[model samples]
Target: MGVTRERAIERLAGRHPGRRGFGGSADPAEAAAFRHAMRGDHDLNPGVTPPSTALTPAAVLVPLIDHRDGMSVLLTQRTAHLTAHAGQISFPGGRVEDADPDDVAAALRETEEEVGLPRDRVSVIGRLDTYITGTGFEIAPIVGIVDPPVPISIDPFEVAEAFEVPLSFILDRRNHQRIEREVGAHNRAYFVLPYEGRNIWGATAGILVNLAEVLAD
Candidate 1:
């Protein structure tokens, strides 16, 4: 039988053993390996400071849904006209506002504003580590579970399309490709997952890669 919404929430809420709940199940050996690998990366280091002068705090909602076959993650493709990361696959989010009290609030508010997902329908499980992007924003990733069969209306000005990718396909290391390029004076390394003519890269890819590493563990 497939995992029900209650079962998934129970797992995330620490009702299950050795499982840091998000949306997927993790084997003991895989979790250990992922932790070991994450420690070596500077970006994953919690102490590293972000380079951007704009102290704009941002929150992103990483929506995980339970499909009959398996789990899938909801992502959005930004319209080409956007000023920032245009034409990139990303989680629905934006800068924190004075009206928003916390990361979860900001994420929910942004999701409603950007994608027309009602705030009340989402059940927030917990949060992952905070990731600092090179682009001048400290991003907090809020993981949440949405009851399936909910309707989504996309805002064309901000989101070109909203789609889901099987979480299992992303968790596999084989699909995660590392690329090297020179950014200014330094050689930078990043990840890219090219799917359906869309190039998933940069900070967006980094966030997914981190989440994948966490779940794979």
Candidate 2:
């Protein structure tokens, strides 16, 4: 019907390496659309080199869990007191540490730390796209399949609650809203996926949009 667990796994497994297995990979139509959309107007061309400005390396696990009907994406809401992204809806992840081998490792490690979803419980399939946020972080969205019934132990300091949204709901283009909003001194177009009264926007919503594009029939 719509975005079943088996179909999602089959789809992600088919993404051939674009750049080192994640960057610019163009399988399942095309990848890294974020590279163009996320860039400043001055850096519009695909060939334009990235600016020298620093973007902290970060990774997020886009966890998909199975259900009798279809798959649902696992997400988290940050605690209100956190210094950054407080009380926002997000995936289970954080900044990539130097000790980590790569983005995948960083994503899994962060997922484990933030939500207590052990690394072994997740079966990584592929990646969505590398998204660089306005906050100066280069994010790698690692797509993975998590078996259901796994215990969740959240770190209260970083996470307020863990929840899931049906993948079908996310993949449906009808729900993806692009709004022009004024920020500081500039107006910017951003994606927002509103679910069950929760405002899912920014990079987290962007990553979900990419997944929807990749898995669309």
Cα lDDT computed for each candidate against the true fold: 0.70, 0.79
Off by over 4 Å in 1: 1-49, 52-54
lDDT (Cα, tens digit) per residue for candidate 1, span 33-67: 33333212235334433441333578899888776
Flag clash pairs in model 1: 30-217, 31-217
Cα RMSDs, all models: 8.2, 5.4
lDDT value, candidate 2, whole model:
0.79
Residue-wise C-alpha lDDT for candidate 2, range 1-217, written one tens digit per residue: 7777678878888664233323244452233443444423213223343333455778899999976777899999999998898999999998889899988999999999999999999999988756676666777789988878867999999999999999989989999988766666766677889999999988888888888988999
Model 1 deviation from native, Cα RMSD in Å: 8.2
Superposed Cα deviation of residue 209, candidate 1 (Å): 1.7
Query: What is the model-wide C-alpha lDDT for candidate 1?
Result: 0.70
Kindly report which residue stretches of model 2 are placed more than 4 angstroms away from their true locations once superposed.
14-52
Model 2, position 143: C-alpha lDDT score: 91
